[model samples]
Target: MPGVDHCLQEAMAIPGAVGASIVDYTTGFPVATTGAAPNSDHEAAAAGTADVIQAANSRSLFVSAMPHDLLEDLIITTAGGYHLLRMVQTEFDSRLVLYVWLDRVQGNLAVARRRMQKLADELVAT
Candidate 1:
C-alpha cells in the first residue's frame, strides 16, 4: 500500500492538479502536501479544509437519512478552480481528508473526483 506522501504524489498526477494534501480534519493539520497551495500558503489551506469538513459534519443539512451513511466527499467550485475533498475511511474512526486543487479551465471534475476517491482508499489500505 502507498503511504501518505505517495498518495499525494499520485493525486498531483491528475490532470490540471495544482496542489494536493492529506489533512487531519480533527486538528486542521496537514500530514502531507505537494505542489502550490492557494495563496501559496499550505497551512491556511489545510485549516480552511478542516473547517469546511467540520461544518459539513456538524450540520444536518448535508447528512443522509439512510442507515450508516456517512459523508464521502465534497467539491467546491470557484470561478478559477475546483476544490476536491475526499474522506479517508479506515478501520477505526478516520479523520483524514484528501484535498486537491485543480484549474477549472483544464481539469475534468469527473475524472478528478473519481481518482481522488481511489487515492483516498489507497491511503488507508494496509
Candidate 2:
C-alpha cells in the first residue's frame, strides 16, 4: 500500500507528467506534492480545481435523473497540456484528489487515466 508521498512519486513517473499532487478538496490544501510549479504554487491549483469539483458534485445532488455514476474525475485539456484530477476514495474523513499535469504532446491520456485509477485504488490513508 502506498502512502501519500509514494503515490505522488508514482503519479509523477507517468509519461509526460509535469507535476503531481494530492490535495484535500474541502480545504484546497495539498497534502503532498512533487514537480509542482516554480514555487510549489500547487495551493492555488488545488483551490481552483476544488471549486470545479465542488460544482460538479453539487449538480449531482439536485439532478435526480443523473446517472448513478454521479461525479468522477475531472479533466481539462489545453493546447499545451492536460490537467487530470482523480478523486481518491478513502475510509477516513479527508476528501482527496490526485492532480497531475502532463505535456500534451508527450502524454498518453488513456494510459495516464488508467494509471491514475490504479494509483487511487492502491492508496492507503494513514
Could you tell me how far off, in angstroms, the CA of residue 119 lies in candidate 2 after the best superposition? 0.3
What is every candidate's alpha-carbon RMSD to the true fold?
1.2, 2.7
TM-score: model 2 vs. ground truth: 0.87
Please give, for residues 47-67, the per-residue lDDT of candidate 1 as tens digits. Answer: 999999998887766466576
**Whole-model lDDT values for every prediction:** 0.91, 0.83
Off by over 4 Å in 2: 38-40, 60-68
Best by lDDT: 1
- lDDT of each residue in 8-84, candidate 2, tens digit only: 89999999999998888888887888896424588888788788778767755653355676455888998989999
Clashes of each: 0, 0
Clashing residue pairs found in predicted model 2: none
Model 1 global lDDT (CA atoms, 0 to 1):
0.91
TM-score of 1: 0.94
Q: In model 1, which regions exceed 4 Å deviation?
A: none
Span of 10 residues, lowest total lDDT, candidate 2 = 62-71
